[model samples]
Target: MDAVRPLPDFLVKRYQGWKATTYADNRGWYKRLAEEGQRPRAMVISCCDSRVHVTSIFGADQGEFFIHRNIANLVPPYEPDGDHHGTSAAIEYAVTSLRVGHLIVLGHSGCGGVEGCYQMCEGRAPHLEEKTSFVGRWMDILRPGYERLAAGNEADRMRALEKASVMVSLENLLTFPFVTKAVEDGLLTLHGLWTHIGEGGLETYDPAAGGFVAV
Candidate 1:
């Protein structure tokens, strides 16, 4: 077995810098969080893309929002087959345990996961179609969204698929009975959001508009 190594020097240095500045400045807040525990009011499910900075986007402080990141920011249908389900577990914890008031699915432009799903659906990504590929299986959750994509050029379709992924996640959230009850009793609200990576622009899903409108 290979021996585990310590963190890279750059990361160590960055952590030291943050500890001296941000952590030092917010020492009391950190202590309070540790003593009181997290009581985040909202939960955000977003893409694992490095550029999708959920905290910076919302100007949120530490321990403010329960954030979960996955490839393409997808949510699978409720399943209790005694298997490992990371995303579902997080949702259950946030909705039932933490009892967050709002759950947001945040999708982003130029998502590699979404692009891969598009290629796979179009029969261009054979590697992702392989049965052994974990990414392929995980991205399968977005297949329905891909099928619902409207007619458009490749770029437009990709953008639409990105948004559709958020909608799909929102739909799947309701598949969880706890989420449905919370939403029905007005304890929780669901939101779908898409953001442009380059422009830093955000749009929210409006059921009345039946499309994304700038926010």
Candidate 2:
């Protein structure tokens, strides 16, 4: 704890400015949110990449989305072994307790985690193959998707794997009993989204079309 340093002046200054403006403009909204607690309608599973901003992209307000971010925006199959499961815990809380109506798995271009999986599966990243690497282990959840796309062009395969990561997460979400029940009862809906970082183009998955379409 002692090793922690104070925040930079630029961050502090910007935060002060933002805080002042936010309170000055939406004082009542802030008060209501603080007093009533959050009732988010959607739970967003997104990447840890700083470039993918859920709020900014969706123009969301505070307390609108319950968000969880991890490497590759991946979700593993439901494993109730009683060990630490951050993402699973978040999903459970969102679905069972918060009763969020929508669960979104968001993927994006040039994902380092997906790229790492591509390298690891291709026998290039030895560190990731090791038992000690956390990122390697996390990206392992996307390996099946990578394998499924192995027959295509290398570049296209990587992009396919990135999109498939969202598919994988969506499939795994159904493995949870509570999630399955909620979804079956029409209490929850799932969505998949992929974005182009540079161009800001977004594509949504269409089950009928079996691919992403411009949204």
| All candidates: TM-score | 0.98, 0.98
lDDT of each residue in 71-169, candidate 2, tens digit only: 999999999999999999999999999999999999999999999999999999999999999999998898889778858688998899889999999
Error of 2 at 99 (Å): 0.5
The lDDT for every candidate, in the order shown, is 0.96, 0.95
What digit string (tens of lDDT, one per residue) describes model 1 on residues 1-215? 37888899999999999999999999999999999999998999999999999999999999989999999999999999999999999999999999999999999999999999999999999999999999999999999999998887999999899998999999999999999999999999999999999999999999999989999
Give the C-alpha lDDT of model 1: 0.96
RMSD for all candidates, in order, please: 0.9, 0.9
Give the C-alpha miss distance for residue 26 in model 2, angstroms.
Answer: 0.7
- Assess the local accuracy of residue 140 in candidate 2 as a C-alpha lDDT between 0 and 100: 88
Error of 1 at 21 (Å): 1.2
Clashes of each: 0, 0
